[model samples]
Target: MNTLSPTTAAQAPPSRWALASLSLSMLLPSLDTSIANAGLPALAGTFEASFAQVQWIVLAYLLSITTLLVSAGRLGDLMGRRRLLLCGISLFTLASLLCGLAPSLGWLIAARALQGLGAAIMLALTLALVGETVPKARIGSAMGLLGSLSAIGTTLGPALGGVLLVASGWQAIFLVSVPLGLLNSWLAWRYLPADGPFAKGKPRGFDLPGSLVLALTLGAYALAMTQGHWVLLLLAAAGAGLFVWRQGRVAVPLVRLQLLGDRQLSAGLAMSLLVSTVIMSTLVVGPFYLARGLGLDALAVGLVLAAGPAVAALSGVPAGRLVDRWGTRRMTQAGLLGMALGGTLLALLPSASAVPGYLMPMLLLTASYALFQAANNTSIMAGIDPQQRGVVAGLLSLSRNLGLISGAACMGALFAFATAADVSIASAPALAQGLHASFAVATVLIILALLISHFALGKRGQSGTPD
Candidate 1:
């Protein structure tokens, strides 16, 4: 795999500009994730549909994005990242408009799914585009910016989406992106250069069958993880193993499993899943504890929960610098250790816990979340190459999203299992038990990730380059 020579310090392509555009592209999907959770009731009222029917609008978006993200990223490389960006932006904008004007639940759901397709393409490919346009050395900075933007979008999305819903109704939420999308598309075409000369990976185009296998395998896995049916989990594992096998046989696969030949890359992916699961699970548990156990209002819980990610976005830049200087191993270790400590502390807190005690741990947890995310993003992007960026980005996105989803599912399962075992959660005590269990599970995942990272970084003697 070929990489471009490092660009001189004077010629940075103003990574900040590329950062802004890519960030804009990324903001849409992350924002869309919970952007409509609140709007569901309103949408049901408007379309005169049942609550369950309206819920499909949100679910459709998740299902579509998760299923198609890998394919979308590969397609970006096979065609052109910029071309796909423009197309996706166009489709996304149109879908947003349609969603705003949706006269019925079905139309809104369909439109939202269309929006998901665009978002999936944009999400996976934007990282790839960053690799192509930005120099390799500053790639860490680019990744940090991307990581910050993702956190910012999530942190700001609920309020932003809520405001849009209130100010101009649901139409405003979707309409806001249309102009941004158009403007972003025009700017990308003008500025983002084609960098095929320094492309990486096997160099052949994508394999459609390989992509479908991934979709089936990963898609099934996501379903199983979400629903937590044992049968589905087994099927997902089988499908994933076969998908990997199939990729090995194909000269130019959608996902190049050979990338994993390096220990660090594998470790990085594992660390991402583990840390993400811990953070995400705690987040889910925190809300439930506040809402049900402690008897707080939804609004209060949201505002309180928002504090963590907000701090995370603010801390991203510093974390990136640390990643560049300290190397990923130290940062990864520190971040995970901090996360485990914070989560464990939260779980161990007494039922009558006060704000003062919670505040410190919350901030620490937020910092860990920020540090781990920025460091991992840097390591993963730097770990692979320009062409394989698509598949690598896809896997990173897949695992990260999957971890968050799985965290929530695991919490529920823990509650069910504990309940069956007759664990009394008087203050909706099962919530804490579930969270504790999730944290413990996350700790195991991170420990495994740490071992993988050690090997991935190579033995004491070898250069830490990709295998």
Candidate 2:
């Protein structure tokens, strides 16, 4: 297949303004993920719905993104990234407006799903554009900036959503995105480079069958994770089998199976899954520890929790620079080592050490995560074939999302098991024991990630090449 070469520093780096537009695109979707979660109770009250029904407001958005992300990326590859991204932004804005105006629970859920579709496109295309716009030498920095903004958006969501919900009602939570979406669209159109013309031939057709099967599979898997249904897990497994079978026979598969054979790419995806799972443990386990073990109030717990993302936001750009200077391989290992140390500290430190003890490890873990994410992403994108950048970026996002889901389930379960009592009634000592056990498991996971990085990336020097 004929394609334009990937953008490189030699071809002139894109302006900082262009990078800002892409950064905004990254921020919007990450914000939406947690923003609505804060408004779930308000939405339940407004719609007079049960908690289960209201939960769909958040689940719909997540399901839509998880199911459609890869397809959205491939569509961008076929239809043109720039064109599709504008459409995505427009759809997101319109959907956000609809969500704010929704009169019933069903309407809000549908609108959230639509918003998720747009978000999937934006999330996938923004990274793809970096490969198309940023110079290779500076890719880590760009990745870092985008990663920082994403962390900020996610961290800012609950606080921002709570303030908006209290002052303006639940509608404000969804409505806020409208103005940001409009601004993002304008900036993207004005600053983003135009797409080169497609190579002439019979245009490549989308893999409808494969997309449908994969979507169903992912939907089932996500449901299985969230709802803890063995039946859904089985269904997901069956769907996966069907997807693999269909991909092998299809004329144009959504995901080329051969791509998975690349040890570097596979390892990158695996490491992302493991690291994200470990990072998510902080979110899943920390709240209980702060409230129970540390005997903090709700407000204090939130304040303590915010420290992690705050560290992530602060360290993103500097971490990216380190990756650029030290090389992806070295920085990747360094980040993992830092994370392992943090996890070990969290496990070993006594609750008597108090807030500072928790914050210390939490901060280190979050900062190292920013470094690892920027370095790992740069390593993956730097060596990718240009034509596959979109789908690959989508895969990276998907792996992270899956890890979060896994962490929520697995880590939460681990904590409960360690407590050996009903979580709500667990004592401070029990909670502390749970925290220690959870971080011990998290440290193990990080060590495993380190092993993967060491073996797959090899003892290479500055360049991220395996010897």
Give lDDT tens digits, candidate 1, residues 1-467.
Answer: 33444452334356666667787888777877777876777888888889878878887888788878888888876776778777888888889889888877888899999998998888888877766666555655666777777888777766777788888898787787788888777666666654343246436567888777777776777778765677878888998898888888988878767777756667777777776776676576677666765667878888778878887888887777676666666776677677767766765666567554555677787788777776677667766766667767777787787778777777656654643443334355655555456555655766676676666655421222122
TM-score of each: 0.89, 0.96
TM-score winner: 2
Residue 184 C-alpha lDDT in model 1: 75
Error of 1 at 237 (Å): 3.4
lDDT tens digits, residues 1-467, model 2? Answer: 11235452334335587798898899999999999989988888888999999999999999999998899988888888889999999999999999999999999999999999999999988888886666566788898999999999999999899999999999999999999999989888887777767768724889998899889999999999999998999999999999999888888788888888877789889999999999889998899888888889999998899989998998999998888788888999999999999999999979789999989988999999999999988888776777777888888899999999889989999999998988788998999999999999999999999999988876543663222
* Residue pairs that clash (backbone atoms under 3 angstroms), model 1: 263-456, 264-456, 425-429
